[model samples]
Target: MTSRASRSGRWMERLNGEIEWHPSQAVTTMTDQAHSVASKLEQLLKAVANNPSLERQLKMATTASAICEVASSAGIELRPADVVKHYANRLLSASDEVSVQNFDLCSWDAGELLWAMKQWT
Candidate 1:
């Protein structure tokens, strides 16, 4: 075999090993995950809105991971990616006037956050 083909085969081997889901299941799995994350986001937002202690803890959280820790302690489900995606969606819908890089938020994964944003550009 050609050297390039040998390297390509090895790369494919590693890729297949690292990925668990079948190609047919990828979309359904991702959709389910998205719904689960959205549910957690809604739950966390409502909890924060209704509970002053939870709100305070969230506000005091220094990072998205910290916020997740706080929420988890309060029996709320939150993930760092969920926090990143939440802000991504907010910014995507926000007016262009609000793109200030002010330290108002905690975590950032803007480049990889939203697949839908690719449609906007």
Candidate 2:
């Protein structure tokens, strides 16, 4: 009778040990899944940050190609050149025009200025 009781106690201890291990295994599996999901989300965010909108990129490329074509037709070679002096000269001319017009400078908001500048571009 004593041996039978001891054997039964050992069997019960083994079963309890397996039951404890099962929950830990489940917890580890869940942790791994969570980590995978977090890593994918981070990668998606980085991709979005690095890539610009396709429509905008297409528009810019088209405009640049058209400019090159027009330049080629006009017998003008298109080369990258510093246009800072040209831009500064234009800005100075615009400032002179704005100064000549005695309008309230405070009323010229940024949005209005940007809209006016877009015409030159």
Candidate 3:
């Protein structure tokens, strides 16, 4: 009878140990998944930060000194965030024909600015 009780106690201990191990393993797997998700989010943020539309905005706003001054005053150094801000500023200031012409010159989709570049040459 004593041996049987001892064997039963040992089996229960082993089962508890196995159960504990699984939770720890699950915790580790969850941690790894969270790290992977965080890394992907960082990469996405960087890609958005380096978007090309921002560069196009800087190029268009810098087409004229007046526009460049406005862009510079807005603290946009041709970087992604600055490009967005500069574009927004230009759109807000787009009341006059000069502003409209400059905005068109800086259009991101169409290669219209190349015409101005050719004329400059």
Highest-lDDT candidate: 1
lDDT of 1 at 95: 69
- Let me know the TM-score candidate 2 reaches against the reference structure: 0.32
Off by over 4 Å in 1: 1-21, 85-121
Write candidate 2's Cα lDDT for 1-121 as tens digits. 5798899999999899878466678878756755554454344344435556522343354333443333343343332221223223335557766744533443557787789899879
lDDT of each: 0.76, 0.49, 0.55
Stretches off by above 4 angstroms in model 2 are 3-5, 12-21, 54-121
Candidate that would win on TM-score: 1
For candidate 3, lDDT tens digit of each residue in 1-121? 5798899999999899878466678878756755554454344335445766534554455444533343444443233443345455557757788677877774455565577678889
TM-score of every model versus the real structure: 0.51, 0.32, 0.31
lDDT of 1 by residue, 1-121 (tens): 5799899999999998999877989878766776787788778778788889888988888778988987796687778987777666566657666745432353547765466578768
The lowest-lDDT stretch of 10 consecutive residues in candidate 3 is 74-83
lDDT of residue 70 for candidate 1: 72
Give the Cα error of residue 58 in candidate 3, in Å. 20
What is candidate 3's TM-score against the reference?
0.31
- Poorest 10 consecutive residues of model 1 by lDDT? 99-108
